[model samples]
Every structure is written in C-alpha cells, then in structure tokens.
Target: MEDEIITDGKYRYIEIGEGKPIIILHGLMGGLSNFQGVTHFFPTKGYQVLVPELPIYDMPMLKTTVKNFAKFLEEFIAHKGLKDVILLGNSLGGHIGLLHTKLFPEKIKALVITGSSGLYESAMGDGYPKRGDYEFIKKKAQDVFYDPKVATKEIVDEVFATVNDRMKLVKTLAIAKSAIRHNMAKDLPNMQTPTCIIWGKQDNVTPPNVAEEFHELLPDSELFWIDKCGHAPMMEHPEQFNQILDAWLVKRGF
Candidate 1:
C-alpha cells in the first residue's frame, strides 16, 4: 500500500476512512500512528479518522509554545477544510483538545478526554516528591496497573523507551514548559459541547478523583472508569473503552 499524506506547507497528517471526522490526539510521547489500533475500530464504526501529531511531535514545528501549537491545529483543520470533527484526545492531547474547543467551539462536535494531563497544579502528593524524574514516571506508571504483578518487564521497557526517546523527550519537556499552565478546572464550566471522560480506575498518573473533578466541573460531561486498568485505559482495556465510546456516541447523537 502507498502512503497517503495531508500536507499544508508547514505540516502534514496521515489519515484514513470516510464519514464524520473523528480527530484523535496522542499523548506527550505519542505520534499519530499511536492511534492506529484505536482508529481501526472507528473506521468500521463509520468515522473518518484524522490523527494529527501535534506540532511538538510533527517534525516541522520548532520552538513551539502552547498558543502556537493550538494555532497549528486550527491551521491544519482549516487547511483540510474539516468541520464538525469529534475531538478525542489522550493525556497531552487532551489538553490540546480542551484548548482547541475553547478557541473554536463551532468547529468541533464533541470531546472525549482519556487520562488527560495539563489541568492540575504541580504539587507534592501525600508520600511522594512534587517533581520526579524518569524514576517517578516509571513508578507512577507501575502503580496505575491494577495488579502490580501485571506490570511486566515489557511494559516497563516500553515506558522507559518512550521517555528516553530523543524527540519524544524534547517534546515532553518543551510542552511542559509552555502548556497553558494546567488548571483547566475554571474553564470546564464554560464548555458548551457534551464531553465524555474515560479513566482507568487504577490510574495513578491521573487519579479517578481528578477525572471525576473534571466531570463535576464540565456542566455536560460523563465519566467512565474502566476496572483493572491504568493510565493507558484505551490500550489496557480496549473492549471496555469501545463500549463506553459507542454508548457515548449514541447518547450524544454523534
């Protein structure tokens, strides 16, 4: 098969399917291809999927800030002339989704944020330091797993590989520096579109209470907590994720 491309001078996207657009955003260490498994299900469900690697991940973007990154998305969508896309984002992507909706509510149909990052103040937890390095992320990722025994060597290696990836780490640090300074709690109440939030009940990365707090703030939002899963609930529990996604889609007339 030949590779297809969606380019607009400065950026490009690889997309698939045909129907109402469902744009998926990957997290800090993720790329557009990360959505392949999840997007596979959407195509069958009749969703024209567009997974754009955010500017920080997209090779062309250099020295990007949160504001410019948001603009990059707007430009990408405008370049493609897409409208009424359902925005589905995970982790860092979720922060972008929220920012995008705030900037152009008319362009998106709905929002689904899973294990989202970038909305809380940086603070020390009960027994942990406020800021930890790779060790912290690794430990936290492990704790998110429902069964600690299931946090296999493979998973640990993958997580370590992700943080240690050169480009991925740069993106992570740069975005951390310029992202709307977290605290989206104040903005949630203003969101007009219906939103569905999914989180792993065992997610130490972003606790269930945090997801619930988002739901409470968003006037029109629902929460689904997948059991026996962790930070990456979509991957850890795809079946439950799909069921919740479809039900939310049906409920919202998407």
Candidate 2:
C-alpha cells in the first residue's frame, strides 16, 4: 500500500497501514521524504506509521528547542487522538522522542531511537551548509553513511533541496545551535519506558561512544550497533535495521 499524507489542522503527515501506531520522526532536515525508504516497511508487518512534517524549519522564532519540539509532539498526539504510540525517531527526531517520552510517558508504549541527537552536543559546528554549496552538502551527506559511495546523486540533490532556501538555512543554524546546548544525559536515568537504541558503529555524527553512554544512562534500554553504517541506519542499512527492529519489537511484546 502507498503512503498517504493526511492533514490535521495545520499538521501534515503520512499515515500508512493499521494496528499499533508507530510515529517516525525526521531529523533536522525536517521532512518525511528522506524516510520514505524505510517508513513503508512497517505497514506490511501490520503496524501503522505516522511521519509528521514538523514545522521547525519555518519557525525560526522557536529556535527548534527540544522542549518546544516535545510540546509540539504532545499537541500532535492530542490532535490526532493517538495513544500508546511507539516513537521511532532519527537524529533530532530522536531527541524530541526522548524528551516527549519523558514528558508524556502515558501516551507512549515504547521508544526506538536511531543515531538520535539530544544525548550529546554535535561537533559539526553551529552553522548550516551555505546555500548553493553543493560540495559542502555532498560532504555532509557522505558523512551520514559509512560507505561514502552510497551517497548517491539523488541523496545529494535531496540535501541540496532542503538547505538551499535562505530561510531554511537560518532555521537549520538555529536548530544546530540549540542542539549543541541540549544535554539529556542527566535525564536518561529517569526515563522508565522500554527503549531501544540503534547506532552506526562508524557514525561520525553521534559516534558509537555516545550510544554506549546512552545505554549506560537508560536503565531499561538495549543498545544495538550496526557495523559499516553511519548516522542514518534506517536509510543506510534498512534490511539490517528492519531485522533488528522486528526482533526488538517482538522481544518487547509489541
């Protein structure tokens, strides 16, 4: 079945399949297009997936703070009349998911974070790639994958399309700066929800060590490391990600 975009008020999202609901959150790039490759996999397994296009990219005034994103998620859940959600968040989306779970534990059943941000500050500097700097965007895309060659032309084009707008560039920088100041290390121990942490062994963005630190922090969490993968495992290695995710879900009795 094809993914369909459904609008609830001003919120736009892709909702697919039925049964237990799984909401997949996108990272700083801020759209569902990059995640389409993996989002469709859940429906066939009898799980519904919702990918919301968060409004952070245009709301520069909010600075894309974790707190605000968490609040947005709360409103999202309430507006959609959703309950017992499993948040599969990647990068910034993961950061938001972690925060949301902490703030609204009753609304979520389990959490899955992949190369998620918010645990630690990124060393990639505080600025977004300059508009029209194709090479810079290309390099950033390459870093997201362990094998740089997989950073295809289409991927490069997608990156270009996201950060090319001046407004988007500004919002990206603000979000990056906010992310740098984010540190959920102190709060992880307090998160009691069943959580799964997935990371790329060679992830240059959120390095493997950071994943280990998260494992140490979350008392009831399990960590999985994927070899030859970088930041975005669901995109870089979907089959392996799917296998691990399916097993984890069943083990958790989802």
Candidate 3:
C-alpha cells in the first residue's frame, strides 16, 4: 500500500479500482495500511477505494483540530474531482467523516463509522504520559483490539514512534482536545445523510453504547454488531465488516 500511494503535491493517497468512490479515513494512531482488507476487497466489488494520508501531525499546532481535518478531507475530495463519495472511517477518522458530511453533505452519498469518537472523549485514550515506556505503549496499542496479537510489532512500533516524537505528541494531544470540543451530539439530528454504523461489540475504547447513541441520534442510520471485536472492526473482523458494509451499500442502492 505504501508503494502504491500517489504523491500529488502535498496530498498523498492510495486509489484502487474504478467506480463510485469510497474514500477511507484512517484514525488518530491508525495508518492507511490498517484498511488493507478494505482497500483490497472494495475495488473488486466495483467501488474506487481511496485511503488518504491525513496530516495528523503536519498542520500547524493551532490549526490541528478535528474541524480542520474535516476541511482537509473536503479539499482532498475536491482535488481528486470526486463527489457523491461514501466515507468509511474508523476512530478519529470516523469523527472527521461525520463532521465533513455535516459541513458538506452535498457531496457525500453515505457514511460508515466504526469505533468513532464524536460523542465520547475517552475514545481518544488518556494522555500518554508514559511515552518512554515501551511496555506501556505496547499494552496500550494491544488494548485497541479484542485479540491482543492483532497489534503487530509494526503497529506498536509506529504508535511508539508517534508518541515519543515531541511534535507529533503535542499535535496528537491537540487533536484529542479538539475532538472533545467538537462533540457532534447536537448536530447529528439535523444531518440527514444515510449512515452505516458497524461496531465492535467488545469495543472498550468507544464502547458499545456509543454506537447505540449514534444510531439513536442520527435520523437515518442502521447499526450492525460484530461479536468479540474491538475498536477497529475492519481490522479485527474485516470479512464481517466488508460483508455488512457491502450489503448495506447494495440495500441503500449506493
């Protein structure tokens, strides 16, 4: 996926297949590779899957907010000349997609969120004060999934590096704070975009109730559950995730 990323000016992304666009948004500590199953499976199903490298740490400190990330997604969509896109995001990425759709609903056809963090602040995780502790970071990373082994060495190492870097750490915290500040509870009722909420039943980060709240608040939404899955349903249960989303898309005629 890294080699396939197209670097167009400041924007870097991976575009696969050809048909209706399904732009993927990665989480706060997640990379484009987290969606390997999604990027691979969707294209064959006749959807153009795109995973953009969100500038989680590239923006100026003051501008590093969830709102700005949503705006950046808007800019990326325009740059690619894409419209009627179906946004599929996890964790912080899901929050950004929700905000983007609220701000610019005209271009989006549907929304899919898993382990998203719009209504819960704890979803961002407590501050990483033990940035120097490898074991601590490793445990934190492993806790993201129901099966601890899913947090591969590469994934833990990437998380370790991000927290250890001073600039990235500050930006990460800034984004977390921004996410808390930009809660979408008040805005969800008004946003009429159809949504697919696939949640990990065992998701401790966002918790199961968060998905229920989202479904209850949103005007048009359907919720699906994956047992024994956590935070990232697409990663832990990619097959189930794809099946649910695919069926939902077909049912919605998207």
Say which candidate scores most in TM-score: 3
How would you encode candidate 2's per-residue C-alpha lDDT over 116-196 as one tens digit per residue? 888774635445466788998888878778999878888788779878777766677777777767678888999899999
Q: Rate the local accuracy (lDDT) of all candidates.
A: 0.73, 0.84, 0.93
Candidate 1 lDDT for residue 20: 87
Candidate 1 TM-score, true structure as reference: 0.80
Positional deviation of 39 in candidate 1, in angstroms?
A: 0.4
In terms of TM-score, how similar is model 3 to the real structure? 0.98
lDDT of 1 by residue, 1-254 (tens): 33365775776677888998988877665545545567778878888888776767554435555656667778878888999889888877788888888888999899999888756522122443213255665575457556665555665556577566776656656676666464577788899888999998877777778898888888999998898887667766777888899889987799
Model 2 TM: 0.92
Lowest lDDT block of 10, candidate 3: 121-130
Q: Once model 2 is optimally superposed onto the true structure by TM-score, how far is the C-alpha of residue 39 displaced, in angstroms?
A: 2.0
For candidate 1, which ten residues in a row score worst on lDDT? 121-130
| Candidate 2 structure lDDT | 0.84
Candidates in order: C-alpha RMSD to true structure: 4.3, 2.0, 1.1
Is 1 or 3 the stronger prediction by TM-score?
3
* Rank ordering of all candidates by TM-score, starting from the highest: 3, 2, 1
